[model samples]
Target: MRQNLLMIEDDARLASMVAEYLDQSGFTVAHAGDGHSGLARLAPDTGLDAPDLVILDLMLPDMDGLEICRRIRALPGAMGHVPVLMLTAKGDAMDRIIGLEIGADDYLPKPFEPRELLARIRAILRRKGEAPASNSKALRFGTLEIDRDARTVTVGGKPCDLTSYQFDLLVALAERAGRVLTRDQIMEAVRGRELEAFDRSIDVHMGRIRAAIEVDAKDPKRILTVRGVGYVFARQQD
Candidate 1:
C-alpha cells in the first residue's frame, strides 16, 4: 500500500526535495509550509484521510514544532494518535528527548540524509503497523486495562493518554508481566531491532507512560524500577 505522508516544513526547497525523494520511495507526500496549515490539514473536518505519518520540522515559521506536537496529541479521537517523526537541529539532544517524551514516535536531526529519513520513517511505521498475533486480545490487570486491538489503555475506566510507541512499549512489558526487562530488552521487544546508540533512554519513555497511567508518577506502584538493572511490571495491580 502506498502510504500518505504529511511534511510540515517552512523551507520550500527542502520540502520540495524531500517530497520528491519520499515520492520516489513509493509514498504520496503532502506539504504544509506553515504550522497552522498543517494543523488545518489534520483537522477532522478536513474531509481528507489523515496521513499515515507526519514528518515534522521543529523550526516552523508560525509555531515551534514542540507546540505543534503538543497540539497534535490533544486532537480529538484517533487523529491525535497519528505517528510523528520529528526533525530537529543537529546535536540538540534535549530537544530530541523532549520530542519523544511528548509523543513523537521518532526524531531525526536536521541536515539529515534523505536515506536516513526514509529508514526512520519505515522504522516508525513498522513499529506502529504490525503487532504480534497475541495483541488481538486485551490485557487486563486490576483496574488497568489495555485493549491491544483497539490500541488503548484505560485505568479505572478512564482513558489514559499515551503515544503509539508508548502503548506498544506498555504492551511489551505487560506480556511479560513479572519479568524484569533491561532497557535494550524493552527496546528490542517493542521495535524488533537492536537498540541504537543514538536512541534515547527507554527511561524517558517509561516516565511518560507512568505519568499517564500511574495515579502518582513520582511513586509508581505498577511499573517498578529494578535499580541498577531495568524495570519490572508488577503482576498484581489496583
Candidate 2:
C-alpha cells in the first residue's frame, strides 16, 4: 500500500507545491490548508486512508500548531500512531525541545529544501520500522511489567498509556536492566542518531518513560540517573 501523507500548511501555494512533490514521489498526499480543515480530513470518521505521516507547520491562521499536534497525539488508534514532522520558522532550541516534548517524531525548520524534508520523513519512517516488535510477553522488573505484544505497560499491575518513544526507551532500558546507557547511547538506540551535548531530547523522552513506569517520576526508582553519566534501570530485586 502506498504511504499516505497529510500536509497541513496554511500557505496554499506552498501546500500545493508540497502535495505535488510528494505525489510525484509516489506517496498519496492529502492537503489541508488550515488546522481545522486538516483535523476534519484526518478526523476518525473520514476513513481517509489513515495517513502514514503528517507534515505540520507551526504557524497557522486559526490555531497554534503545537496545540494541534497535541490534539493529534492525543487521538486514539493509528491516527495517533502516525508520525508527525513539525515545520517551524524558528530554529530556536526551545521550540525543537517543546516539539519533542509534545510527541513529535521529528522537526524541520522552515525554508527547508523539499529533498531534505523527504530525507527527514524517510528517516523517521525507517526508525519506526526498526522499533522493537510488540508481543504479548511481559518483562517483569520488580513491580514493573512491560507486555510488548499488547503495547501495554504496567507498574505494580496498574496500567498506563505510553507514547511510542516512551515505550521504546523503556524497552531499551529494561532489556539491559542493570547496565548504564548514556544519553547519547540511549538516543542512538532509540532514535538512530547521536545528538549533541546541549540536546536534552533523550532526557525529555526518558522523563516521560520514567513517569509511566516508575512509582514516582520525580524520584524515579526503576530508572535511576547517574549524575554526569546517563541512566540505568535498577536490577530487579528477587
Candidate 3:
C-alpha cells in the first residue's frame, strides 16, 4: 500500500520535486505551502484523509514550522499522534534537538538526497509499525502498563499522552527493564539505525516520556538517569 504523506514547505520548487520523487517511490504525497495550510489539511472534519506521516519544513513563509509541529501535537485524538518528519538545515543540531523535543518523529537535514529522505521515512514508519507486533503482550511494572500491540502506556490505569516515537522509546526501555542502556544502544533499539554523533534527541524524548509516566518528572522514579552515562528503566516501580 502506498503510504500517504503531507509535505508542508514554502519552497515551491523543492516541494514539487520531493512530491514527484516520493510518488514514484510509491507514496502519495500532498503538498502544502505553509504552516496554516498544512495544519488545516490535518483537521479531522476536513474532507481530506489524514496522512500517515508528515514531512514538515522547519522554515515556513507565515509561521515557524516548529509552532506548526506543536499545533499538530496539540490536535485532539489520533490526529495529534500522527508521525512528523522535520526538514532542518544541515548541521543545525540545535534545531533538530528542539524538533524532537516538540514531538517530531525524525528529521532530515536540508539539501538532502531524496534517497536518504526515503530511507528516513521508511525507517520511521517501520519502527512505528514494529511497535504493535507483539501478540498484544502487555508489560506490567507496578501501576505502569505497556500494551505492545496497542502501543499504549498507562499509569495507574490512566492513559498517558505520548507521541508515537516517545511511546516506542518507552517500550524499548520497559522491554529491557533494569538494563543500563547507553544513548547509542537506546537509539539503535528504538530506531533500528545508528545514532548520529552528539545527537541528544534520545535524551529529549526520554525527558518527554518521563513527564508523561512519572508522577514527579522532576525526580523520575521509573526511568532513572545515570549521570555521565545513559538511562535505565527501573524494574521495580510503583
Candidate 4:
C-alpha cells in the first residue's frame, strides 16, 4: 500500500516540486501552505485523512515549526504517534535540536537532495515497521518495560511517551545491554545509516529518551555515557 504524507511548507514552488518528487517515489503527498491549514488537515473532522508521516518546515507563515510539532504530538490517540520529519535551514543547529526534543522523528537541513529526503523517509518508515526479533517479544529492566510487539514502553507501570525514532534507539541500546556500542554502530543498528563526523543527533535523541524513561533525567542510570566512546545500557537496572 502507498503511504500518505503531509507536507506543511510555505514555499509554494518548493512544495510543488517536493510533492511531485515524493509522488513519483510511491507516496501520496498532501500540501498545506501554512501551519493553520496543516493543523486543520490533521483535525479529526476535517475530512482530510491522517497521514502516515508529516514533513514540516521549520519556518511556517503563521506559526513556528516547533509549535506545530508540539500540536501534532499533543493530538489524541494514534494521531500523536504519526512520525514527523522536520525541514530546517542549514546551520540552524538549534532549531534541529529543539525540533527533535519536541518529538520530531527526524530532520533534514535545507538544500537537501531529494534522494537524501527519500532515504530518510524510507529509514523512518522502516524503523516504524520493525518488530521484535524472534528471540524476544519484550525486554524488562527493573521497572522499565519495552514491549516490542506493541511498540510501547512503560516505566514503573506508567506509559512513557517516545517518538518512533527514540523508541527504536532505546530498543537498540537495551537489546545490547551492558555492551558499549559506538555511535556509528547505534545509528546503523537503528537507522541503517552511518554516523557522520561530528554528528550529535544521537546524543540529542538519547537525552530525549532518558527524559522519558529515567527517574531523574539529570543523572541517568539506564543509558550510561562512555565518554570517549559511546553509550551502554546498564545490564543491572534498579
lDDT (CA) per prediction: 0.88, 0.78, 0.87, 0.90
User: Which residue pairs does candidate 4 place in steric collision?
Assistant: none
Clash pairs detected, candidate 2: 135-148, 135-149, 136-149
- Model 2: per-residue lDDT, tens digit, 46-130? 8765687899998899988898889898777878777888998755678777877788877787788898878777777766655
lDDT by residue (31-84, candidate 1, tens digit) is 999999999999989877878999999999899999999999888866788999
**Cα lDDT tens digits for candidate 3, 1-238:** 8999999999999999999999998999889999999998998889666688999999898999899999999888778888999999999898988998888988888899999899888887887777363556799999999998888889899999887778888988888899999887887777645567777788888888998999999999999999888999999988
Worst 10 residues of 3 by lDDT: 127-136
Q: Give per-model TM-scores.
A: 0.93, 0.85, 0.94, 0.96
lDDT of 1: 0.88
Model 1 stretches with alpha carbons more than 4 Å out: 133-135, 192-199
Ranking by TM-score: 4, 3, 1, 2
Candidate 3 clashes between residue pairs 3 or more apart in a chain or in different chains: none
After the best TM-score superposition of candidate 3, give how far the Cα of residue 209 lies from its true spot, in angstroms: 0.6
lDDT of 4 by residue, 124-175 (tens): 8888887675566789999999998888999989999999889889999999
Name the runs in model 4 displaced over 4 angstroms: none
Candidate 1 TM-score versus the reference: 0.93
Predicted structure with the largest lDDT when compared to the true one:
4
